[model samples]
Target: MHVEWRGRIVVDPELHHGEPCIRRTRIPVSVIISSLADGISEEELLEQYPKLTREDIRAALAYGAELLQPKSI
Candidate 1:
C-alpha cells in the first residue's frame, strides 16, 4: 500500500520499511532534508539523485513543515 503525502512524498510499507520517501523512488524525505541542512546545494542534489526534481525537493520540505506543525485538539 502506497500513501501519498504532500503530493510528491509517499509512504509505502513495502518500501524502505515504510519510511516516507519521494514518490516512485527509494530516496527517503529525511535524507533530502538532512542533505540540504548540511549545505548541499539543490543543483548538487539533483546531480546526486537524478530521479529527483526541484518540485520533489520542495515537496519534501513541505512535508517536513507539515509534520512540524502543531495539531489542534
Candidate 2:
C-alpha cells in the first residue's frame, strides 16, 4: 500500500543522543517499531499511546527504511 511518509522523523547528536525520534517529540521511532515487532497491533498501539497516530507509525517505518537503504555511490 502507498503510504505518505513525511519528514517528521529526525535524528541529531543533540537530541536523544542521536536516536531516531519523531521530530518534535522525544518518542523514539524505534520504540514504536519495537512495540509492533513484539506483536503490538496498530489499534493497540493507538489505544495504548493516545499521543500517537497512524501517520506517526508510518513515518517511523519510512525513516527506518531510509536508514537501511544503500546509498548510491
Candidate 3:
C-alpha cells in the first residue's frame, strides 16, 4: 500500500521497510520527530540533512500531529 501524509511524506513497502518518510528522500519522519524531541533545532536539521527544507520539517510535524489525533468511530 502507498500512503501519503501531508503530501510531502509517504510510506512505500520498498523503502525503509515501509516506514513513513519525506517524499523523494530516504529520511524517515520518525527520525525528524525524534531529533526534534532530542532538542535539535530546525536549522540544525537542515544543516544535518541538506536534502530537507523548512517545509519538509513542518510537514513531518503536521503528519505526526495527525497521527496523534483521536480516530472517530
Every candidate's lDDT: 0.90, 0.83, 0.91
As for lDDT, the candidate ahead, 2 or 3, is: 3
lDDT tens digits by residue: candidate 3, 36-69: 9999999999999999998899889888988898
Task: Give the lowest summed-lDDT range of ten residues in model 2.
Answer: 1-10
Give RMSD to native, each candidate.
Answer: 4.8, 2.0, 4.7
lDDT computed for candidate 1: 0.90
Q: What's model 2's TM-score?
A: 0.78
Q: Give the local distance difference test score of model 2.
A: 0.83
Off by over 4 Å in 1: 1-5
Candidate 1: worst-modelled 10 consecutive residues by lDDT: 1-10
lDDT per residue as tens, model 2, 1-73:
7555567777888889999887677878899989989999999988987788889999888877777989999
Q: Is candidate 1 or candidate 2 better by TM-score?
A: 1
